[model samples]
Target: MQGALRFGARLVAILVLLAVLYSAAALSFALSPVSGRPQQADGEPLVYVCTSLAHADIVMPSRDPLIDWSTHFPAVTPPGLPAGAYLAFGWGDLRFFREVPTWADVRPSIALSALAGVNDTALRVIAINPPANDPDCRALRVDRAGRQALIDYIRATLADETQSRPVEQAHLEAYYLARGRYSPLRTCNQWVADALAAAGLPHALFAPFSFSITWPLEKPPLLPGKS
Candidate 1:
């Protein structure tokens, strides 16, 4: 019994150590000089970087009628968004996004697979009018080229065939399309960071969490009613 107890204690210690190390590495990357660039303040053609409690998304205007979002992701606007909708793009674990509508739907296997890097990647898209600036979301401006590059990156993430597309979700009124694979190291948050970097924006070298991805957008994060 004592031997078993010792073994359990050792396991706990190892887990705690791993968690600490992970946190330290993430923070180091977050505070690095590379991620310190402030969001571009140039007006118009602004793009929003939104985040929820556990996820991050890029919100951009639907300026080009040629690339109509409704035609591609019709689920976003069933009755047709006449005024057009601001497109929000997010990436996550394929199975988790399909099965887990909210955090409440999380399962042990889902969590473990995402953390173990054994999961496939999927994209989540939503089209809303005027875009949302809720407590969880913050807007950032991007140049025309930057926005186009970001869109290109998203398109590249999607497989070249329709067979890769997953079934649309009825809950969030969003579509889940198969894209890159996911792992502990290549999490959705990391993808967001990479997207920002690919677009010539400043972002953490390894943003593993939503907050880390959102933090660099504003220095000394603005508290409620303070800004």
Candidate 2:
């Protein structure tokens, strides 16, 4: 019994050390910014980057001169979405999203499967009318070229016929089969960071957490006449 107790204590200490190392690495990489090319050229369009406690999402206008999101995402919009709402895109492990609708529902097996790097992933798209003063939302101005690059990067993640396998979830979100592997290293927030870099937008060198992407962004400006 004494030997078993000693082994358990050792295991706990090892886990604590690993957690500390991971936090240090995450913070270090997040602080290292990857400077992007000048994106404030004339006529640049605005896109929003939003974050929750654990996830980050890129929000784009539903209908833009470059593309109509509805055409690409034909799944029924969540109820209460207006005619021209914005679309927020996110990526995560398929089982994690389907089984764990809320953090309260997170299971050890599901979490382990996601971190194990052997699970399928999915893309989450939600229609929302984002508020101007939300601290979690920030606006980024990207030129037409940059916007196109971002679009291409997102499209590349869609699995074949992803639309047919849509999994509607609460919070007015839909999940589509996505092409990618989720692991401890490649988290959803990191996916957002990668997408920003793919579009030549300023991004974190490495983002394993939501704050890594959201911390550097500026809050969106208010619309005309609205305080």
Candidate 3:
């Protein structure tokens, strides 16, 4: 009986060894770069550049609605523009509020913002291509020229003294607008893309599925839907 017990113990040890080997193999396969593609997260269908005004406080609605439009109108309207123009121009505030914080956090908002101010939908359509799962997908970075232009535009817009009771107030207004429009989902790489586009630099958006990955992965395929 002792001998039989020893044999049973040996059998159990072998099974355990085999199981360990199998588990190790499975783990290696899963982690291997060539094994499968990385899974794609749900993301926007396209990439876009955000407008400068979208980030300003003047454009964004205040927490207190009563104090917003009526109280802020004198401060919000640009000099030399009619009240109707302010209303129309202020629509950008909504887009800013809705924007996601970063490209990884919400790609569609980035795409839409990037496409803003462009009248051609076809061009906008071309700017939305970037793989959701690609580590390099967030690499879009803004260029120096674009950055300077944005800064200059902000400076000019805020320079009008009549727009505010004080020059500082105008500055604060611009600051709030920019802050509100700032996208968290936007990556440095994406900013480069946006900045370039903002400066009239040319680029194209590709289909996300076009990216080739060696690993066995799952990316949510794009489907037809309203933007």
Candidate 4:
């Protein structure tokens, strides 16, 4: 029984060490600023960065009907989204797309595989019509150059280099294969933070969790007519 006890202790120590290293790396990459603050130019677009407890996504400015997201993405965007709906984008492990059809399908092994970056990646898109004053969302205004750079970075995340456009798959509605190496170190939270930094918006140097990314947006409410 002493042998069993020693093995268990060793396992715990290894796990603890991994946790510390992951935390350190996540903070190091996530927090570093991309560049100086962006200057707002004429006709700069305004976008929103939103997050949930486990994931982070971008709510694109989709109020304009002329710009059909389908043309750009060509994927299964669920029908019946409101005319003024915003397109939300999220990136995650490829195994997560194939295996975890629902949260119930998640297992410890699968989660670990994903966190270790052994799996591929996918991008999920959805349409949303959030309330005008969403406390959970933060607006980021980006100049033309910054906005273009962010868009290019987003498009480059597609997994298929040959496919100039997105390859729509039937089984997973509103999701497409994405390019990028995702691990515990490069998590969804970090992706959102990186995207914001690319857009030249004010952002944290590092964000490992949804709260870490959204904390800057969630300030105490202001009184009516108060600055």
Q: Per-residue alpha-carbon lDDT of model 4 for 19-81, expressed as tens digits?
A: 898677555544553333535544644667776667888777554322456556544344555
Model 2 pairs in collision = none
Native-referenced Cα lDDT, model 4? 0.66
Pick out the ten consecutive residues of candidate 4 with the lowest summed lDDT.
216-225
Pick the lDDT winner: 2
What C-alpha lDDT values do all the predictions have? 0.70, 0.79, 0.30, 0.66
**Which lDDT value does model 1 have at 115?**
74
Model 2 whole-model lDDT (C-alpha atoms): 0.79
TM-scores, one per candidate: 0.82, 0.85, 0.19, 0.74
Clash numbers, per candidate: 1, 0, 40, 5
TM-score of predicted structure 3: 0.19
How far is each candidate from the true structure, as Cα RMSD in Å? Answer: 5.0, 5.2, 20.5, 5.3
**Number of clashing pairs, model 1?**
1
- Model 2 quality (TM-score): 0.85
Please identify model 1 stretches exceeding 4 Å from their true place.
33-43, 64-67, 77-79, 161-166, 220-227
Best by TM-score: 2
Candidate 1: residue 173 Cα off by (Å):
2.8
lDDT of 1: 0.70
Question: Residue 80: error of model 2 in Å?
Answer: 10
Preferred candidate (TM-score higher): 2 or 3: 2
Q: What local lDDT score does residue 76 receive in model 2, on the 0 to 100 scale?
A: 35
